[model samples]
Target chain A: MNKILSTVVLMALVVVGCVRQDESVIRIGAAGPMTGDQSKMGIDLRNGVELAVSEWNEKGGVLGKKIQLVPGDDQADPKQAVSIANKFINQKVAAVVGHWNSNCSINASTYYHTANIVAISPASTNPRLTQQGYKTIFRVCGTDDQQGGVAAEFVLKTLKPKRLAIVHDNTTYGKGLADFFKQVIENKVQVVYYDGIQTKDPDYKAVLTLIKEKKPDVYFFGGVYPEAGRLVRQAKEVGMAIPMVTGDGVYDPTFISIAGNAAEGTYVTFGKDPSGLPTSKAFNEKYTAKFGAPGPYSVYAYDAANIILTAMQKTGTTEGTAVAAYITKNSFPGAFGDISFDKNGDVTKAPYVVWKVTDGKFVEMK
Target chain B: MFTQQLINGLALGAVYALIALGYTMVYGILQLINFAHGEVYMLGAYLGIIVLGVLTYWGLTAYSLVLSLLVTVIVSMAFCAAYGAVIERVAYRPLRNAATLTPLISAVGMSIVLQNFVMLAQGKEYKNMPPKLPTEGFNLLGANVSPVQIFILTASILMMVALQLFVAKTRLGKAMRATSQDRVMAGLVGININQVISTTFMIGSSLAAVAGVMVTLYYGVVHFSMGYSAGLKAFTAAVLGGIGSIPGAMLGGFMLGLIENFGASYLSSAYKDAFAFLVLIITLILRPSGLFGQKAMDKV
Candidate 1:
């Protein structure tokens, strides 16, 4: 009786595992911060995936099978994200649309690569995410190096500040972006001050005071909105009236609310606003109508999801390795325009644009 | 430039001093590090933000920003005092007679609970205080000193003075000092040990609350995790001054702020936090009892 029970359980386990990858369904995992301070962005990314998957399934499904989205909340933490990636691997997902944070994505990338699972990020913009030579990892957004270079060129050409001060919040994303910005503008401008502040530091006056003495013409901050907002407000309080610039991290509406009037005239660099693109107008309308209003990376999330599904459909198989290769070989029309991954799995020709905060909202500068 | 940096250091140091006093006082009384003290500081900040948010919604913010701030400070202090007292009762009281590590672990557990509670109550996002503090300032030796900085310095000093007087001149303060010196003996001497411990936590929490309000005004933003770094720095300050000495904590906080700002300005700002620890290690090596700590003799 014991031998019969053991053999029956073994057969049941194998059958249950195989049930998930049946030809009737294709599963894609979406991992991001669904419960922490960055939940807003995570929700937007999830909603984007949902919209894309629903639209794809509506168009007679992919290879005569409905696509299923499995969302995992990593809370924007590296360790948690790795566990989420492991869970997706256990479930044998065909592809993953994930990891809103650069650090989180980087942490989970190795796991996905080792498992031969194709992963695409909607918003992890750090260049190192692709530079690590992971064939299975891809992103729909421009890297910090590209965005930082555009920002530096604009600051040098338009603002033409003689003395520049650079500040970073000491995160992988923040420091990487600032370093890239410095590398591009070091020869052209005098970077009189360079400093790193703690992520949640409540005061920047001391650092701002030091920067004030040097009389920098512009201050470049490479950090997210929370710290960036405080830095801008405190810099104003310290009476340093120079123009402050930051990367895409501070492009959130909350930045304006936190910095108040101090955010006005602040220069920011990000991928050109997809909502305003002619190709994305219909998607943006549909997104806003469905989920209130889409976040900064929602369009990119839609593109990432569409890229993965289109690859699966074009390859006519849910095999992860083949689909990942197909993604690189063909260009797909996405909400942001033509999407193709380069050798490093980075989106090809991901353009950056300058934006200025006028009144209260971000207005793209020509 | 040097003078301006010095002024900046002083202002930043004052905020650290405000927080360090709470850690020193709790350690003095119970011999417990009270790791949960950081959560109390976080709660104080959220309280301040909530009170200000409600006032702004009611249109009372435009009535008088200074008066509104005064109200915020009081409400935050009162709420934090109760919270600190309750934390001691629920978490620390049970572990009081247990092994030393027990209460320390309990404090850590309570800190996590309080952090999650606040995160749930007031969303995990950073809350910004409206730009109410006046940005105008006078040049002091070519350094820009804003009114908010002056207010922080003046208010912190005043609170420290009042605290000193309370500890030195009052009967309750004497009971607290007695309990710190000899808890069993003080209990035998008719002093209510529980009441004294509660008062110590209350006072310490109120001071932390004031620091929270000052930081919120100074930074114009508050977040759930702000306490961790601030609390770490303040705890470092307390140790540098003398773990259980009030004056030592104050001096240590100022020294840390000055050292950090000067180091960042002159040396590398990337190693700013490292400089504080380096000074701490060097100072402790020379004087294990801290700059103001009394040498304790092992009883035979």
Candidate 2:
């Protein structure tokens, strides 16, 4: 009889533990690659989300409850992204701001739509991500279609080379950007050499030599910072000194550091510098004080988190469908400016600008 | 273009040969592949960065690039050698008499552990090796070869020659040969089997360290996962040349490098890695014992 009583006591404690976890707190999920090669970007995204959540909690949170952040690391992979989405759904988070990679965002959006949970991707740029028509999916960044077209316009009007060479890392984002650029410029100029390179290989001399032999007047590469750095460095090493242009994926401080002196004279297409705007001054100062400097996508992540929090406050409830519906129908002030999602769940006004690396710094090209 | 690609292929092959020697040496003695060997090479590169960073801070690099590089290479090689011995003792020595699969699994586990450990300690970003050498190069038939590439090729060749001499002429070398030939007989002759095995690992690891340092100088970038693809290619080179033969490994490394460069040049560059494996498959089917491997025989 004494043993049976102890067992009954243990079961009561378990029931109380589960109930306490769900009481008086609003949970928001943040997903990104918190580990692996892209962990730096992931950590930056997490930091941005944390800053926004903490600020909300300091303001007494939404509906008189404390705010909680649930972080999931997808490791920048698609399959892992689906698992993270399911986990967030099981945790019953009101909204999500995450999935930095385009592929991850695209894969996880299906589950979020099925569960009626809102997910706002801060950095995924592939056009297919928003083209899927998932009502629950949203993004703060511009699509590759816009980014690539901007780059192509710059190449044709500004650089105006007779022969151009295009290369990509063969990833979803890279290939998509390259293809879009090609669609715009294939008839205007001669594409001397076109190919895809394996990411993270660290040796591009073979391909660089081939491109050098072709004698293209300008070279364009569609990839992230790591491969971009290596490609330019190796191209310089191989005596191919042509000017190179790339998409926003190569627009990080890490690229300059990795490429060293070779980074000079390279052009990158990205959104206009938002840190200099008066609206973002406070966010920049707070972020810099906490995490050294804001990473390339930190501002977007901060805006994404704030969008979710504002939607929750206006709806006055943590229900997924209700909050998502309110977010789609309203405009909210963000770190960049006023952000309004279109019917397709994309930012309507994302302006792409070209920046040049001059004297080891990325300067906005007027 | 052909000459330039040839030069590029040679430089890449030299590094692969350096790494392949480690795989070949370990397999020569214990008949077990050290999957953790690549991690050792990676650690060697990280060590190079740390030491080089310190030297640069003290202005030693500015004083003399050659001296600073020499000190960095020596220090990194020493540390990696010790690391290799510890790995062998803790992970491989205990399973020496167990099923061959046991140590193989342990090797893979150790590789994962080391890779993660470095990732955590170094922060997952790619650490740039501050360029100490001049990038200027001499042009030959429209192909420019940088000074750093020349340094890599010369350093690799010198170390390989030194290794060949050490193995053929030293007392320790003779004991290693005896142990590889017949461990029981060598132990009966009062040879210290443990010491011989440790020495082999030390030499192999130091060679890999040298290769690691060379790679950083050549590429000017290094990361935690750099070892995985490099180690895989070096392992392929070792098997293609003959798993246990030193000279065969060198020959195989160069051939694979040239094949990859030419294949990428003439065909699709995206399939660059695939070419190495294709050659590996054809080699395996055409000559099961490899190019230089002796035919297998059953003991009576």
Candidate 3:
């Protein structure tokens, strides 16, 4: 019994000493909705960072040292994200790669800034995060305006629907995307209506009723799947004669299951076509082999992780300042595409891809 | 749009009524609120999700929704009822002889503990009941209403009617009312107050289970922390309707729902919560017994 207790004590001591304050192991912090509505995003970010670490460690880690990925669940709550940011600072992590929601990333940015910690987000698209001019912040994804511009141009120049109704969740991403779509399409097409919905309330029939009344040829929702699916079904019931469209947040299996046949004609935006892209085929095989499901943000997260590891290798330091400098200075090939952060922490004018939901598969728009 | 808002309100009201019934039943008897009651409601949602996941894993989607919902309801009720009884025995019963504030504080602690337990187990993910409740809308007087709304209303009314009949006719129901009225008198009369209280928990927890499943079916997914927000809303509904009255709780729930829906449509959607509480405050000020509450003031 004495030997067993001593052995247990020794193991605990070794583990504690392993994570010593001055250890070479670089701790990378990632914050996302690990348990809530945007869990897929968090899962994707987790998988991406995990794969990046494994790949980097396999090829000899940055500066001849191992990399440790630290993930914090923010549950997509802005306050929780802020709290996690403070925790990350207290933990003295080298860098952070996280936060899909703009609201979360925005709140977490101030903390990373205060601590001079380098932060890289894979999918927070709100322009304000960049416009805030926080030097510590970086993003792998484009802003709402850029996404809207690409999507709006494609819609007008390609699909050419007669009348389009725009809707949003009235949050940073939702409202930002809706406003950009509105600005881009108002001159080119007959914009029918702009509406905003709440987060928790179950019904969207009123909006659907209004949509049916307006008889818009097309409907675009700047929100996630839970609300979008309801809107789609309610529109069909109320006989809303419109093809539904959405931002990237709506491209999930949940949307198809909820809307069922109503989801057939829906169009959504994507950063890359999962099948057509080289990374998609590779990541698809690996992810299916590993997690059994190819989560929507998996590739983007994989690329974000890849970028951080590549920067760590180039800078020869897991130090935030060094990594950020190397990341901004260098363009690295990623799962989605070649990624290089501009001064404002976003991909320099990347275009968004449009995908149509057909038979529950993301068929790339021709 | 006004009619549409009213219909939406009625559907929401039914949901609030069912949830409030669970709370009011417990409060009516023990005067000790089971804060973990919401967690039980949340557990019911998780039960439904787990059942669906298992069924989906086994390719049981071909099974009718009625059958699936039935399984969900039974499993959720069983789980929550067990949890409710355990919570009462362990948390509330310990503080039975303590001051009134002691039990209330213990209830709050239990609520936090239960919520955190769920958070630890499920993480911080926002889960829904599943499939985002049926999207089919039925027309009501030139206004569109979802089948989910109709489903919630019909099921809740049926539950209320059944509860009323049970409490009026059943021997156990009479014991429950007796105990609720005077625990000492009922105990002297050989009512077995313990059994009455346990039965009260069983009934209330079962109602919460039904509400839990209905909420998930209505929203289409279940999350771990969904109980906290919705539970608070339902508690407000109970208080608004008169905490001790069954029918009043139901009426208050519907009224709160209607007010929230209309407030969202015409006023700010963000302020819908504000409107719900506003209704509660106004009711407290004007008619404290609630819209359907029966006043039986007694002085010892």
Clashing pairs in model 2, backbone N/Cα/C closer than 3 A: none
lDDT of 2 at A296: 85
Please write out the lDDT profile of model 1 over residues B115-190, one tens digit for every residue.
Answer: 7887788877778776666788888877777777888899899999999999999999899899989999999999
- Model 3 chain B: worst 10 consecutive residues (lDDT sum): B291-300
lDDT of 1 by residue, A97-204 (tens): 989989889999999989888999988989989888888899998899999999999998999999999999887889999999999999999999887887655666
lDDT (C-alpha, whole model) for all candidates: 0.87, 0.89, 0.77
A308-334 per-residue lDDT for model 3 (tens digits): 777777777666777777888888886
Candidate 2 lDDT over residue span A143-244, tens digit each: 998998999999999999999999998888888999999999999999999999988687899999999999999999988888899999888877789988
- Clashes per model (N, Cα, C within 3 A): 0, 0, 15
User: Could you give the candidate ranking by TM-score, starting with the highest?
Assistant: 2, 1, 3
iRMSD for each candidate structure, in the order shown = 2.2, 1.3, 4.1
- lDDT, candidate 2, B1-300, per-residue tens: 899899999999998999999998998889889999999999988888889899999999999999998999999999999999999999999999998789999999999999999998987888996577877788878778888889888988999899888889999999998988888899999999999999999999999999889888888888998899899999999999988889989988888889889888889888899999999889988987678876541210
Docking class of 1: acceptable
Q: lDDT winner between 1 and 3, please give it.
A: 1
* Pick by lDDT: 1 or 2, better one: 2
TM-score of 3: 0.85
RMSD in order of candidates:
4.4, 3.7, 5.3
For DockQ, the strongest prediction is 2
